[model samples]
Target: MSNIMETSDNEILFIVKSTPGNRQREPTESDPVVSTLHNRKVYKGDTTILAAEFSAKSSVIIEWKKNDFTIYKESPQYHAGQSILIINNVQHCHHKKKYSVSVTDSKGRRVSSSSKMKVRRDSGSKISSSSSSDSDE
Candidate 1:
């Protein structure tokens, strides 16, 4: 497969579909860019979401992992129809490690849609509290 557009850290906007052995249609920014993975490179203590999208004729597979541990694979997202993978990593947080994801076609040819799994140590946290009875007293 050919990379019609350079991968971007920003949100993707378009994808090109071509006939076999023909130049794929160059998608303008207006075309929908389907993604099978998001935040592919997440850290152990970091919690994020994974998601993707596709058309009626397109299919995808998502494989995610931490180190050598396989977290997910060839998984179907958003039921068995439109492709989407939404993964909340908060419950499965492990030792700080880089997460990986691989996306492919039904025939196993890969498409370039990778991301950085990053964790910020000092990003701070949100604390919620009501008026404590002990403190109120």
Candidate 2:
């Protein structure tokens, strides 16, 4: 932290407003200091659906807000051309939002993607899956 010399009342107030990094104002005599803000990964905009091939079907759990939307919860059976898309309906989630998708391996670990997508409106487009055998010449 750096010390500030009292310039003017307005300038000093502006400096207080522009503090860098995480912030939690000192508590008043009766109240405890509180900083409830968290930095969470966010996606913006309508997402796209793409074609993919899955060896087996598993439940897809989405954690947004206080709700979790699921697919094939009781029965994890996803077939070819299955859709996976995110609609931008959540607050602060901009259009064509970016999400960090975690695909797990059989070992129960996650695999992250290094790329992001700029997609179309959720309901306007659909994502499907496709599979084929690998080929080598």
Candidate 3:
């Protein structure tokens, strides 16, 4: 339990009190709050990260997918702490693709969000070579 008090100078103070057999409270079967999915554009061969943020008091399951294919669902790739999906050294193959994340709580409550990834060609690369010699008539 906690109490809030106001001083004469308009300063607020909080006092926390503990009781016997008191434990932390947990969320009760409420739908998870998920962040809005935003589209991203990046240059080819660039590193980018896709994050799926959510809030829940209980244990939840998270899954990351790309074009209906599963990814980062296991260890070394799945980061449950920050709820983020990482893509290193992005390439043209990742362009114009759909990425999504789904979260589910123990009570069967679920939430999901998806966004499209757009890739652009690098400006520093040349496509063709120019010749110095010209035709004479």
TM-score of predicted structure 2: 0.26
How far is 60's C-alpha from truth in model 1 (Å)? 3.2
Q: lDDT tens string, model 2, 1-137?
A: 22222222212111111112221243232322212112122222322222211221222221111121221111122211121222322223232223332333333433222213333233422222112121111
Backbone clashes in model 3, listed as residue pairs: none
Give the deviation of candidate 1 from the true structure as CA RMSD: 15.0
Backbone-clash count (model 1):
3
lDDT of each: 0.34, 0.23, 0.49
Runs off by more than 4 Å, candidate 3? 1-28, 74-81, 123-137
Order the candidates by TM-score, highest first. 3, 1, 2
Instruction: List the candidate 2 regions with Cα displacement exceeding 4 Å.
Output: 1-47, 50-53, 56-75, 78-83, 86-93, 114-137
Instruction: State how far residue 69 of model 2 sits from its true place (Å).
Output: 13
- Model 2's C-alpha root-mean-square deviation from the true structure amounts to 22.8
Error of 1 at 52 (Å): 3.7
lDDT of 3 by residue, 1-137 (tens): 22122211112111111112211233345875555566776556655556545555455666566787655342222212335554544566644577777767667687888877766677323211111011111
Indicate the TM-score of model 1: 0.38
Per-residue lDDT over 61-133 for candidate 1, one digit per residue giving the tens place of the 0 to 100 score? 5444555454455434321222222333232233234445554555545543443344434422221111212
List the candidate numbers ranked by lDDT, top first: 3, 1, 2
The 10-residue segment of model 1 with minimum total lDDT is: 128-137
